[model samples]
Target: MSGIRAVADGLVDELKRSLPQQRKTQRGNLALLVATMLEVRSANLMDLAASLPREADRTDMRYQWIARTLSNTLIDPDAVMAPFAAEVLERAAADPDGIVLILDQSKLSDRHQVLMLAVRHGERALPLAWRVEATAGAIGFATQKELLGVVAPWVPAGAAVCLMGDRFYGTADLIALCQRRGWDYRLRLKGTLTVRDSSGRTTTAARAKSKDFYLEDVELTARRAKTNIGIIHDPGHAQPWIIAMSDNPGYGTTLAYSERWGIEPMFSDFKSRGFGIDNTQLRYPDRLARLILVMALALYSAVSTGHWDEVHHPTPAEKNI
Candidate 1:
């Protein structure tokens, strides 16, 4: 237990050192924040406080302070994200497979939808940035575009970037957005959608079915905007799956599309598997957004620690940072 505290304290100190000097007043609250996260191993403020050990000097402190500190922390989300962004960028630059960006939305009840952007590493998608919108159901085109736009500047110039998402995200506007950003994207398409084939013949995607096929220089229309699309059909035991992309369709596209599931574990980590974020009672978007930054830090810390330990123990290839 002492060793864990020492490690958590060290992590808190590391986070403190990374902050701007002007934010000196936040150091203590930041320490409490990190230590609580490490102690509870959860992102919920109430849970974190419940797990905290009683300090010797702070006799008047209450568990409620943990929630207050989290809510009122002086740190800007961008400032908190800078080091993480740098780390992911570094990894992306070194990856021969290049960077794969996964965009997805996670919903809580019908009130909050967090549009998340994460970079794929092995089977896990480590979150890079996200935007919280109050509406429910599926996220809109404008919101999706806005989130991707936030991620675009971080990607290195001329580096391979592939955006993967479900059928709801594979809209013509998003495909065009990826094209404008000069990045590759693969999005699952509805089986019933109309797509023009290579020979300039229009047909429903369901009619173009084969065991596996890649058709290049196709066209897909959404919201009356027609854009060049590539379609890939790979039916491997599951129902026939169709994907639309700006790049030419091939086995590579299908394989890349398979990696879209990597982001699922991340959502699980944020909810049932790790932080219990779905159980959080807080309903305000801004406060929830602040909480997410803290959750991101906890995630980054756990993954980084696990990765360092893996260097010594050499475990099986599971999700590490």
Candidate 2:
């Protein structure tokens, strides 16, 4: 058998084990598509169809089959991703430093934006959940809350989770969501946001001096959500890092905002670097979201395989040096 077929067969068994409720035909089709994507490393339907191991003689027939799978409303991305996400959270919960979840958005095309939530693993991150919208602007807090709500139950009870996000996500609503879920956060604040300190003195976050500083017990903006603010203005950067955290503010706590960068590499993998998903011509938001689900499954499979290999069969350099 071809290597792609071999991989697909293995994936079929794994998917059956994880998603037993799914129809066998659905699971088999998904496995073949994911295996083909790993081999072609592209999201162009034609490229994927060309590599897909199917009984159909015509490439167009294969392409239509792939499209039908993506367009199937019965296939829920959340249900497909839950098993993989559960394992990721389980491992993270075992760590002493706890799980780091990063929230961000990226443009998929002229018509679509993907709001993604990812879990930090090693130097990169793995997809946790995502929502695709047909808008150029932010996906908004309602959608953000919905996405977080989906992943909240998958987290192990009492697991330490610190969510990190850029300025777009640093809002009173998101902080309130984190507080309600009993998760920690390191969300960056916009410099123009109104902040009132413990002394009742009101000022903008940008009013702080060009040096590292911490503000405790500050009420942020008109909503007056209580949080600790951490500011770090290094020598060359144009803007300082104004981070809000649930913990006591300090240099180290503020600098933990850097962990949010882990999501960037995962975005690249979905775009030009790995799958070239941005090249896809699919315009329907739901179909594109399903395609992202395929990519997410492929990524989780690759990462899990690599980790297993590293543990059972390390390289000579890894074994020695």
Best-fitting candidate, scored by lDDT: 2
> By TM-score, how accurate is candidate 1?
0.84
Q: Residue-wise lDDT of candidate 2 within 241-302, one digit each (tens)?
A: 99989999888998999999999999999998888888899989999999999999999999
Give the lDDT of residue 318 in candidate 2: 88
Residue 281 in model 2: lDDT: 93
Error of 2 at 140 (Å): 0.4
Candidates' RMSD to native = 4.0, 1.4
What 10-residue stretch in candidate 1 is worst by lDDT?
222-231
Candidate 2 has a TM-score of 0.97
Candidate 1 clash figure, as a count: 0
The total number of steric clashes, by the backbone 3 Å criterion, in model 2 comes to: 0
Q: Please, what are the lDDT tens digits per residue for candidate 1 over residues 97-153?
A: 789889888985468888888889778878888777788778788878776776677
Error of 1 at 125 (Å): 1.4
